[model samples]
Target: MENAILLLKHVGYLAVLRDMESFNFSKSLLSKRFEKMIVEEEKKKEGKNEKLLADLCECFVLLNQFCISKELLSIVLPCLLKVGLDKDESEETQKEVEMAFLALSNINEYAIIDKNMYFSEMKEIIQHHQEHNNLTRLAYHSAWEFVIKRFCLDGSLEDVISNELHFAKEAIKELEELMNCVDWKRTKEEREKESQEEKVLLRWLLTLEYFLGSCLLWNEKYSELIRCVVQVYQTAKGNNEEIGSRCIYSLSMAAKNRAMKNEDLLNGGAVNAILKENQLPTMDDVNTQISLKFLISITGRLKGKKKEKMKEEHRKGLKRKMFEKMEEEGYEDVITSFHGIFVLLEGCLYPFISLNVCDYFVNV
Candidate 1:
């Protein structure tokens, strides 16, 4: 079984390397055999054949590295997640569980597509492990990787843009928990020793970053997310550019999209917190980008009382009109809408204009 897994793993890997989109694991005969093996292996394990259980568990982990068909996923995802996520005292049982999660994460893309079946289960698995911090570092990372990969640019953007904020809200909560888990007092050498832990923490940030990038809308309720992101930027900028850069980009998007009121961000004081630090680390490439986005959002949101009065009177009709246009304009159209407005202002702007972006930027 082990040798068969490796042979198939390499063969699938080459196919993925050749053309991932075209690659499909076409081994129905083998899959049938493995399915029976999995069922039989359970009885063998009950008979104390520990080797079979370990081999089967290891098989799932290794075979999933490249890709798996939906048929394979239907067979593997539930089984792996069910067994892998169980917290056990036995070292061997623990190892099997760990491998199960790691393997499941590799094929999480497929698992997520059939959201009705596995979405909630996978999310619950991640939440359980995150709250308890029970999984080994690699296994813990796999849990996060599984969810984060769902939002990859090539995949469906619906999860990010869905009116139901379940995924986004939970992600921000997870980000907060991961932030608390980080040991800021650890020395550089100590951090180096535990790079996997560091990576798990970064994964949380990346997950949120992916969310902010893909999401096209936000409401006042999500203001806390902006605060959490800024908190991450404040701590990580001096030492970790990757996290800081991602935070800044997230901030830019948060402000650029159809975001919440500026006052909500202002009240949180997270954007203001960025300015309190004199450190020049976080302003690498997106300083101007962040500043411009916030500027547009603020100026866009802050209109005259007359406009407000007009909005109040015409709210219903305006909503109908805007909603009618939204589908046509879409996110791409809205983002690029600023392009024309900027072109008109470019000539009036100074060659070098210095402004405290930390002020209105965070307010957005």
Candidate 2:
């Protein structure tokens, strides 16, 4: 029976992959196959068969990397997530769960650029994970990250930010429950636990940290993003250099995006608040230097097109403001380099001026 089930699961994995590439397969066709595969797998006795079933599910994860048939991708991708959450053995099951999520994120990345026909179900898939299973929660968190990235990065999806925000509010309500879990707080009584369990606890914390950071960066949720950074700092502080550094990294990303969009965050003052609240290194700290580099590039790219429209005085004022901020923060050399590059750019005024002067010279 176990062999039969394992064989069927492998066949199911192949079938789904084919369907993802097939022109004839509809979303419902893949959904039916998924249901059938899950039912058949459930009948097999636990242990070796369960592991085989997980391995089978992991095979379809490559579907995330493909751009073909998103409707089919949606149907096939969720099967991996289902397999991960269904397998109850946490210690042994981590690889499968992580693979499932990585695959699902690829699907989400593909979906972000495609049409919205699958969103109803895609939204439902993440919502279900957020509500019912901790193992699946991070995957769901990523779904919203896709929504935010699509909504903001592409500019084409800006119209849907409000709709996505509505979903974000709903997802946030669910994440609040995870914070209540005993494992989240790692209280004094729980500290005496074995090292392995501590590692597991730390993994979840880092997952939450990245998830929160990605959500904020993608969605422009600046205040909530700052709050998450502060929460991580208050709890982890000096004891966990890695998490604290990540929290700072997230802060820089969130702030950098806000600065680009010109979104007015409340004067709660996140940079100072985070700095004062926890003594984790400053933005100039070596660990966070990469994040600064990413922020500068991202901000420049975002503002590149729009900056041309601003008056000369306006552009100068903005540049001066940024340069002053950088110098005051002890990043003067980076700011000076940025300005040196800034001077080399062909000014936005050239094309019109060139056009008019050519016509004048031709007439003369």
Give the winner by TM-score: 1
What TM-score, computed on C-alpha atoms, does each candidate reach?
A: 0.54, 0.46
For residues 45-137, what per-residue lDDT tens digits would candidate 1 score against the true structure? 357554554455445445444445555555566667677657774776766666666555556443335655565666666666656766665
**Residue by residue across 1-364, what tens digits does model 2's lDDT show?**
4675446445534443232443233244553564456456656665435555454444434332443354444445445546544435475464456455544444433344443543444555454554555444444444454455444435554434334435435433433444334253456556445243333233334334333333333444535535544565455554444545655555555444523232222222443444243223233233334343433543463355444445667666655655454445555454343443332222553222322222221222
What do the candidate models score in CA lDDT, each in turn?
A: 0.53, 0.43
* True-vs-predicted CA distance for residue 257, candidate 1, Å: 4.5
**Residue pair clashes in candidate 1:** none
Give all candidate RMSDs, comma-separated: 10.7, 13.3
- Model 2's TM-score against the true structure: 0.46
Q: Whole-model lDDT, candidate 1?
A: 0.53
